[model samples]
Target: MLDYLVFIGTGVYLIMQTLGGDKVRGLTIELVRFTLAYSFLWGAIEKFMQPDLFYHLLEEHSYLAMGMDWEFFVRAAGFVEFCCAWHIFSGRAAGYAGIGLMAFFVIAAVIPFGMIDFIGHFLFIIPLIAVLFTPRKVPLCRTACGTTLAFLVALALYLLVAYAAWYMLYFYLHLDLFH
Candidate 1:
């Protein structure tokens, strides 16, 4: 199944990174960073577009309920996620963003959705952990201009890939995402 492939592929990727040499480790870390950025960006956009899903979840399950203004909480959360994704993508305090997101997930898993959400999001924790452990170095582009160009290119590529994946899931597979 596709789910099994994802799990196995992730495990294999992590294992490769763990046993890899220094260059391999660096590449893998960058890969993980890009992946986290892409995922968070997509998630933030989805939350902003379809806030009712998160609003309902927070109202029904979250311990820190927002009561009548639940939509505010949803939008706030989406904004934070968007900011974190930007930070990660731009190589600006990316590790801090990863750590913050990790903490948020820990709280969410404990205070709201419990084991099911925890298990479902367990794979997400891996990249965050990797980002936390990875050293903060200059991005592949050394100069300011180069860095800006690289960031723009990376963002564009990530958005395109994410959109393609979404299209495949929604149109081809007929998966009812976020429902």
Candidate 2:
């Protein structure tokens, strides 16, 4: 059920991002942006409001011992997440920001939680690659390192934006793969 929901969400987001026509794309982008931004913003607010929640989670998982002040890091992460969401909707630096955020998430998952959540984050690299490789602008010369870098960055962004799709594929669409 959750997987299905995430699939739907990812599908909607991709369609919205790739949709043509300025008016339609603008509206769709706005809608997607608002939703994405609000999600992270709310989460940031929540974490700020309830500082102990993260602390308790850390303790429960034995990730870190008691009395570590991670509130600043948590707040900064929330701000960055919110910014990444904003960038995606704006279609400006979104591609780069999205990819960077995904990488950050992957690192965070592996270093803190071990390999448990790593699988989930690792699967996001696929859609990201697709999005990155999709030609956005015409190139004067294809050999430019800048172009390749752009593609890589875009791939990263795609991974971040389409992460729900990965989750859906792993958790719901095809359970056997993960198993």
Candidate 3:
């Protein structure tokens, strides 16, 4: 949904980096971060919501899923994506998480789905790199109770955001595609 924003933000970021527009560069990076976080969170929601779809997909196409437990794998994948999303949002340990996420995207999505997945995920690559390398300017507090509360609140709020985004896309695309 926000693929364009990621692409444009990344371009502006690179340009600003070389041209000395510090504020513009920072803003673009933030834009990339927010979009990537949203994308990862949405993907996690899908994994959590429909394990059967993912399971059948892997079983049908992936040789790796031949002997492994599909159910456990799906849940674990969802949890990993959720963690990646949260780290991206919190801007804490994002580099660590982002690298894992990029690998996951390549191994899980692009490799299995091929060209379609590659095209869909192309914009994500740069944004993930942005979050991976650029530390947050105003970092979120990890020690404070209020900061913890705020982060939790943001997580809860994202549920509604996800729902709203779903409904917004419902009319434009086939809902059965996600199923």
Candidate 4:
């Protein structure tokens, strides 16, 4: 799927950043961070928008919700995701977000949906590795305006592509967006 391909692109960018990428390191890092933040933002919003869908999935598959009520589990999952997304966007706890979210996707989506879920949601794992391997000396941003522009652009792109993918699923593929 197109979303999975974006992972490949992200991986390539990550690789470039790892290997003497002084050409655009600041911009690249900012873009990667913002893209990831916006991606998680979309994820949290989707869950909040359709809690019943996740609740039913948890009810059916029961991914170690720790004996919690399904409704509470859904809300907690959304809140966790929302908070993590904010923290990552704010650069407060990106490493923790990467680790926690990678585990969450595996436990919540991949375990229930099988290979398709892995294919669709495995991108978060890359961030797990990225945060672990990031160089300590982060490059200083060239300008506040440039950083802001990248954040806005990443948000727009993430929103547009996500909705476009949802549209294809809802229309051409005859799949429910939140069912």
Indicate which candidate wins on TM-score: 3
Better of 2 and 4 by TM-score: 4
Cα lDDT tens digits, model 1, 110-150, are: 55567876777776776666677775587545566876677
Model 3: per-residue Cα lDDT over 1-179, one tens digit each: 54335556566667777887765767767777776776676677777666788977886776655567888777777767766776776776654665576557655767667888787776776566657788897766665575567657866776677667767788569867676
lDDT, model 1, position 97: 63
Query: What TM-score do all the candidates reach, one by one?
Result: 0.64, 0.45, 0.67, 0.58
Local distance difference test values of all predictions, in order: 0.64, 0.51, 0.69, 0.61
Instruction: Itemize residue pairs with steric clashes in candidate 1.
Output: none
Off by over 4 Å in 3: 1-22, 62-69, 144-151, 160-179
Give the range of the ten consecutive residues with the poorest summed lDDT in model 2: 1-10
- Over 4 Å off in model 2, which ranges? 1-6, 11-46, 60-68, 122-131, 134-179
CA displacement after TM-score superposition, residue 67 of candidate 1 (Å) = 4.3
Off by over 4 Å in 1: 1-9, 18-23, 62-68, 140-179
Could you tell me the lDDT of residue 38 within candidate 2? 40
**What global local distance difference test value does model 2 have?**
0.51
TM-score of 3: 0.67
lDDT of 3 at 95: 41
Q: What's the true lDDT of residue 156 in model 1? A: 70
Q: Count the backbone clashes (under 3 Å) in each candidate.
A: 0, 3, 0, 0
Question: Rank order by TM-score, top first?
Answer: 3, 1, 4, 2
